[model samples]
Target: MFCKAFRVKSHTALKSSDRKKLRGDISSTFPSLTTEKLAELMPPKEDLTIAKVFVHKGDAVSIYVHNRNPIIFELARNFYPTVYTLWRHPDLLPVFTTWPPVFERMSGGADLMLPGILMSSFGLPEVQQGTLCAITLVGNRAPVAIGVATMSTKDMLASGMKGKGFNILHTYKDQLWAYGDESCPPNIPPEEIEVAPSANLEEGYLDSESPAYITELENLHLEEVSATVQQESGEIKLSTETFQEEKAEIPYVENCNTSLQETMDDLLHQCFFHALKYKVKKSDLPLLTSAFLRNFLFACCPEGQQVDIKKSSYKKLSKFLQAMQQRNILQVKELSKGVESIVEIQWKHPDVISFVAPETVLPLETCETSDGGRKQPYQPPEILSLYGINAKMLPLFQASGHRKGDLLTANDVRSVIITYVKTNELVHSDNKNFVTVDPVICDCLLNASEKHDLLLLKWDDLVTRCLERMQPSHRVAFPGSSPVVRKGNIEAIDISVAQRGSNKKVTIIKNLELYGLDPVSVGSLLQQRVQASFSCTVLPGTKDRVQVQIQGNQVSQTGKLLLEHFKIPRKYINGLDLAGKAGKKK
Candidate 1:
């Protein structure tokens, strides 16, 4: 169901009470989960977000995201586990195993057909219709898909294991999984992978064209049955260790001399040079080391390939880049204490000059820098602090046809007062700037001193007093959402420098959630930009609001990130002057 992209309706941090309720709900729903296991899934200290989304078919789904991965989602009040959640606890639900090749079809939104299932001698797990279940590959225990049973085990066997088995909702490579870190399924070994029974010779089973395929499957099933029968009769014996080792054999390089580590190092260097030759441009210089690796180097990798630095001899991107620097391929500079950048590149260097550009390069989009191009993240609507019409200002607003509780900007307030004066013909004929103060205006917009003596007021004075008499409020309107009016002033993004321990200084930022900036994402971006260590902590007396703490004084960088990257107005951000003299001001 989640194969296509979905629209996010609302993303908000789940309240503590709601979180507790959800935990209880999940515990009751999945009774096998213990208190400790549930705590691990939904950590108390971590931020849990409940995102309301509309799928392609306009079905509303409430997804609970933890650590950027959607663990659970609710559709029609029915909770379903995500593939991410099933990975850790594979046996949480009744599992059905299928051939590896069937996953490609399932990822494309196809249902799990009985023909595709690898039936074991023990038969399928007994499940009622609409019971949530997990699907795993033939040899791997890690679940790659989740769905509800379309029929019970009795019905499935009664029908000779034909027709649909499970209605696949979310799959490994679907849009739901893309919402996460996009980590591949782990290679978890299955306890007992079985072959399908050959009794039901359904036509077009597994889309097989040749009879040999069906014959081979039946032979495999028979072989297993024969072996089991022989073992029971003491006619043959099998070594458990050898059998497990064969089943768990990971496909590595056939050559014994070459290690996987060496292969990874070669792959990293190949990708690095490929990026330099075909991807990296001169404008991209002064690129952050982290960005260079994540954006440029990784994008240059061939399709279906990945570079794992941990497996390489260099072990780190910095070490790999340092080795490249030694080879005169690029100049790595530590512009800041920990932050490193590729300030210059040797385009004419022997290695770069001799590198051949591939005819077909992966069409991967890299993030645009401020100079290279504009790559903006999803920014929330600009917050506007305005006046809300209260009971005191209701009389004046009513004269202009504005109801109470109507939020108005300064210009809006002035316009309303002017409209009221003109409609009442209270403007002085001699001087248009002066307005005859009516009883309603006198009561709502005037103080005791001004009301007792002054009958006529200047237009500006009338407007100013009208604003002062109104209650303070703010409005926030996210895209595709209605404007929300809240009481009191909006909290500003607060940045301050505090001394940690004796000598260490740290920059602390808070109130980011109010502005739609995720503290975790912001801190990660800041860490990459400044090459500093950072941490996110939930603020006390707040509804799961996070505060970002970074090493050293990062007032300048933090301000720039909010101003440039997030496009937040300076008025909404505090501590600009605290950024020191070198900080950019606008």
Candidate 2:
């Protein structure tokens, strides 16, 4: 029949820390040492010779230690170290249990156990060492097994058993309990062994800090780049033929490695062009088209252009034709009809116009100035282009493109001696009377001239050079010659000074109080004199209103004008006063 037995548990937890206190306690209570002369009388003992090894005959071993000395604190560590080495051997490990009594003294008919007792004898001091150092084996204690290693006691003492990794040894007090003895120390617990985390967890791709390999590699690379030209070589030219051969292998490049940079310029131009279709200033539209096309061609067109016009961009544009017709946005017979009518025949734009022309007769600023002289410091093409004039007329400013000019000046700017004004002018009728228009026309230009007063600075020479020449001939004669505030046909001229040094400017052009004249024409002429400067203000009769052209060359009133016109204000003139008392003589 098999029976379960309890092997010793680990005694590493014994906590030898109380040894000092225990020593103090023992010294205070126990009597001082007295060497028993009897230890000297019993002559030196012979070698330990076991006649019969009675190890665990039933439960425990019986042995005698001759002339054992008293235990003391001075030699405790040296004494304890030898006993601790016993359990290092596998063969001696099983038998070691609790601390064996150093000496069992008979006192008052009771057995007294004296532990950690130092003794003097051949096998005594070395009882925990040598071949006797093996621990007692103790699985089944009925017949305990005695552990042994085939080596001399001295050899065993000199070379202690090698440790079994985390395994622990056992001893009794300061003496290692021999293998044949009954005492055994407890075994250590499993929880005391702890395992660390794996190496992969400590070193991972997404960790806060990168792996060592990359950092070290980058540092090595920078070192190489910085040492491109060493001090040992005094001078070097990268462009030399030999160097060039080496450099060619290095592969010089200009951002060719960048992703999609080559197409960015064209893409940007296309976006701007497509966006321009929604809303843009009338004046700016032509300039926008010019800028877009010029930059676009420079950016997108392959150099050394060989454009076959019919085939160029035809395929890309052609695809949209079918999509347009099938939707029936506009009903059409077929793709051919749509293409022929819309795309091929009438879709003309001057974007493709060339620069060169013959017999176009370009402009020269000095156009036979009576004595034939030239005017230097010519204005740029944009000045002439503002009025929608042809570019060929301006020799100085034109870059062979469309141009516009102020018709008032260019036609009459020449220096000529003419003493008389044209007697029959638009303002001067055949009978020399002021031309009368629907009074509303005068009201409209005065109403529109209100967009002024944002001005912080004033030009001292408010009248233009061209107008100054015409002033002598037309200031007292024509409305255009008078200084006025203007926005196209809308104007405020014939300004009545509010008060002396009033600092007020341009109230109304050709007010009803004055004789007839169109303020729009006057204001336009005045605006021409100042180039294209404008100011912002609101007139007395108008509030948050402006004259915007509704139809071609014609404008409509808005805001307060609409309100005031519909509701005519009743005029009340206080009756003149009559003095009655002073008239008694009458």
Candidate 3:
């Protein structure tokens, strides 16, 4: 749940009474923790702070932070240890081991699948549904993730290990880990050593009772399996045979530089096409080359791979772009001295048309992990649509040196209307709250009914009428970019309940792209959080425009996600009132 950054609602030092109670709660939550260990984890003199925070999905949690690391969190009145707590005490909870690749996927916000788990002769640990557990990587005992069991051990075995094993709540390298000093998980060895998994078992099969398996390896122990298995300095040494087998799988590299250069070039092309296809939007055109490379290209590089232009054949990003330009892929122009921007891209170029993206590209949301992780998703600049001075109001605005079509915010409109009233001496002497209706006020700020019924109007009513008479317009501005003034209101995120088939309801959300949200990422997040299936499809007749369809009536969840997590203004969200009591019940 904390994979996303949370907003700290309140932070305060822990009281003495609360400290003692917290220690007791920790002791009770994990019976494995001893008094001494608990004391070390939570010292009396060390100032602990209770941080009441809310995650993107609107869940309120209280976290106990020590040395800037969140050690424990309280959710729904139950206490759970953070990965920091598990790092110091590795054996505090039952751990399910998985492959290293699976850990990266989990950190990217995926549940632990049963097939990815590594099992031993002793079989999986016994845990009931909702029982909290830790996840470790193969050959290392350090816990990398924290989750809860999706089903009982008996149910997992009954299903033949074919579905989601755990619902991962937090993982290493996620926002929760970014909350602390961002330390990596230290390698820790298991207390007891098990024999290396056999080739068949590594392929995800366990035939323990088979006659052939029993005859080949019965009652196998580490020493009996191979004399090469040994313990040195508290670390287990793998069997020589196993080491040789793994070594054989790796291809030999003749020269390190040649291999590195080829790898870097591959990364460049992969990220280049990936960025143009998914990252760049028409609104982001005339994008700076440096910003494109630093923000988009590098972000698309696969995990554990760094993109270095110097290592590639081009030796420079500009050279690579020059090569692409020669191939008719895109055009670059130097708009200012010593600075270049990508002017145009040929969308129908064969290279662009046939560029199939990789299945796993690092999402831009968590791409800033190399830097300090973001506290929340990217918030597009706030755009406001308000009244503009029109032909009818031009005569009144001329005295204030305002143009005929100047855009005005609510406050600006009020200020101008008030100034006009005061300058014309339209305020009634007896009642200062009212303004006398003159010819200009009648033409520009009065309705037919008000003009016929009264000679005077309330100050607020006059301002409201003046604003209603103005033209509609919008303003958009962000750091380092020119402000844009348009004549129409910006489109809001559209959400509506639609019937898929007979009696089947689905929530259709569109216009998220306008707000810098990826339709696929948002759909995946909701699918995991709501435990519902979702699909994304391009809008017909529109290229690059997509909509997300989620099963069931999930209007409330969608609203909270957009409003709280993404920091979107309520005014920019449409159809929230459609989230009836039924949606809340879900």
**How accurate locally is residue 264 in candidate 1, as Cα lDDT from 0 to 100?**
77
Report the C-alpha lDDT of model 3 over 1-586, residue by residue, as the tens digit: 7666565444556889999999988888899999889888988887787767677789989889885588998999889888889988988888888645456557777788776666676778889999999998654577889999989989988987766788888887777777664656665655464444575343343323222333354344323443242333222323434433443453211112245467778889999998888888878888889878866786676643446686689998899999999999889999989999999988778887789887766633421321334533254666877788889888878888899878779898888888988899999999999999888887776667777777999988887777778898887754334667777678889999998778999998988866657675577556544656666666667755778888888898899778765777898999998785853522
Model 2 bad stretches (over 4 Å): 1-219, 224-314, 323-586
* Residue 194 of model 3, lDDT score: 46
Tens digits of per-residue lDDT for model 1, 1-586? 8877665555667889999999999999999999998998999997887877778788999999986689999998878889889888888999887654456567766777775665665667889998988988655678889888988989987876656778889988787887665666766665743444544333323322223444575555433432110122211222223333443353311113455577778778888898888888998888889888766786666543457786689988899889989888899999889999999998888888798856544522122222212233354575777999888878887767789778889888878777788888999999988999889988887778888888899988877777777889998875544778788889899999999898999999998867766665577566655667676665777645778888889898898778865678888989877774655834
Q: Which residue runs does candidate 1 get wrong by more than 4 Å?
A: 1-96, 99-117, 120-135, 138-180, 186-197, 201-314, 331-344, 347-377, 382-386, 428-432, 580-586
* Worst ten in a row by lDDT for model 1: 226-235
Q: How big is the RMSD of model 1? A: 13.0
Between prediction 1 and prediction 3, which has the larger TM-score? 1
Local distance difference test, each candidate:
0.73, 0.23, 0.73
Clashes of 3: 0
Question: On a 0 to 100 scale, what is the lDDT of residue 355 in model 1?
Answer: 82
